[model samples]
Target: MYVIHLRYTGALAEIDDALEAHRLYLGRQFDAGAFIIAGPKVPRDGGIILAASMDRDRLDAIIAEDPFSQQRLAHYDIIEFKATRLAPDLNLPQSPWL
Candidate 1:
């Protein structure tokens, strides 16, 4: 699993300008089963994305396609971790914490 944290680096106006395209990019990823959930931060300064486990290189390429990244409007902090647990409703493979 991965937590893709995006911190806005451009002005709000600039971020807004690219928001639509960014959303489209997210939608594509979601359709491809790369993203599980995504939303803006509480302060609206950035966003968070929960991504399904995948190859690091593939994830990087996906991130690079984000409009925020293409426009250099945000900085990304990609945190990868082993998911030792999952919600009952989520059909992930059983882990130690299951």
Candidate 2:
């Protein structure tokens, strides 16, 4: 799977405006099964992580439609990951590697 890290770097005002659209987009992804988990940073400064499709091209296309990207409210860095291990108690229907 891949993790997209989105960090806000511009004015909070712009981020606020984009937040709603961003949330909606994320909801769509969830409904479409393209998004597994997503949320903001705990400290409110680290950014957000979106764990979903591993295809960078597909992920990039989705991010291109994000409000943050469209409005230039934030910058994003994507990282590809391979699931080498998972907690023994962890339970998920799909492979953690996606």
Candidate 3:
């Protein structure tokens, strides 16, 4: 699993300009089952993406397609974790094993 943390580095206008494109990119990833969840941060400074079922290389490549990344509007921190547990009601594309 991966937790993609994005921090805005550019102006708000720029981020707003690319928001649609970024959302579209995310939509594509969702369709492909790469992203489990995504949304803006509460402070509106950036965003978070919960991703699964992919290797680092591939995930990085896919992330590069985000408008924020391509236009240098944000920086990404991709964290990998071995998920050992999940709420019983939650289901994800990747297997969360012990």
Per lDDT, the best of the predicted structures is 1
User: Of the candidates numbered 2 and 3, which has the greater lDDT value?
Assistant: 3
Task: Show how many residue pairs clash in every candidate, following the order shown.
Answer: 0, 0, 0
Evaluated at residue 81, the lDDT of candidate 3 is 90
lDDT per model vs. reference: 0.89, 0.73, 0.88
Higher-ranked by lDDT: 1 or 2: 1
Model 2 per-residue lDDT tens digits across residues 2-88: 677877887877777778888998898777667777888876643665565456777788788888888787788888877678799
Between candidates 1 and 3, the lDDT winner? 1
lDDT of 3 by residue, 17-87 (tens): 99999999999988888889999998999999998856678888988898899999999988899789999
lDDT of 1 by residue, 1-98 (tens): 88999999999999999999999999998888888889999999999998888888989999999999999999999999988877878884322212
TM-score, cand. 3: 0.92
Candidate 2: residue 78 lDDT (0-100): 81
Model 1 clash number:
0
Model 1 TM-score, all chains together: 0.89
In order of appearance, the predictions have TM-scores of: 0.89, 0.81, 0.92
The CA lDDT at 44 in model 2 is: 65
